[model samples]
Target: MPVLTAECDPRNIASIALLKKLRFEQTGYAEKNFDYGGIEMCDTAYFELKRKT
Candidate 1:
């Protein structure tokens, strides 16, 4: 089996904690944020979770 990953706002402490609780691991990070609508966030953090085999 493979794994799933996601990118989330680095400023969201609660979301980060929840992902960790869900067995996700920190995988990658981006210092520059993407422009959304008309605003940009601090940064993006990546996470990954391997599927049970």
Candidate 2:
């Protein structure tokens, strides 16, 4: 089967570690803003991942 990849928050240390353990690589990044309750927050960092063969 072909390998699949996904993107997630790098702020989540556990998830980043798991992806590294699985051989995922940082390919690109993007900016995103989200609203929680009544507050808006923005993130500026590389948040992309890819499978490494």
Candidate 3:
């Protein structure tokens, strides 16, 4: 089996809702460094979908 993984900013409620609607499950949470305008620590929500066998 394989898994599809993704991460999104925790503050984005719309994205989170969309992911949930698509049947992806929240796997974990973490703080990740991102370089949007400059390097900064951002809280992330991890999601994953496991392939049905």
Candidate 4:
């Protein structure tokens, strides 16, 4: 089976590096509004991950 992972958290440098090391590529992405403490915000970013062979 193929595995997929997405970086939805903010400013995760280590995770980005690890994904790159694992040969992950940026395919496509999407975002939506999230409410926290009565504030509306969204996690904006591109998707990255590797597929298992």
Mind giving the per-residue lDDT tens digits that candidate 2 earns over 1-53? 35556566547678777777877666655565543355645443343344345
Off by over 4 Å in 4: 1-3, 29-53
Candidate 3 per-residue lDDT, tens place, 6-53, comes to: 899999999999999989999999876555565677888999988899
- Model 3: per-residue Cα lDDT at residue 23: 90
Residue 14, candidate 3: C-alpha displacement in angstroms: 0.7
* Superposed Cα RMSD, model 3: 1.7
Ranking 2 against 3 by TM-score, winner: 3
Q: 1-53 in candidate 4: lDDT tens per residue? A: 66575654345677667766777765645465445457656554455555657
**How high is the CA lDDT of each candidate model?**
0.88, 0.57, 0.87, 0.59
- Lowest summed lDDT across 10 adjacent residues in model 2 is found at 42-51
Off by over 4 Å in 2: 33-53
Put the candidates in TM-score order, highest first: 1, 3, 2, 4
Give the higher-lDDT candidate: 3 or 4.
Answer: 3
Give lDDT tens digits, candidate 1, residues 1-53: 79999889888899999999999999989887766667654578999999999
Any residue pairs clashing in model 2, and if so which? Answer: none
Which is the leading candidate under TM-score? 1
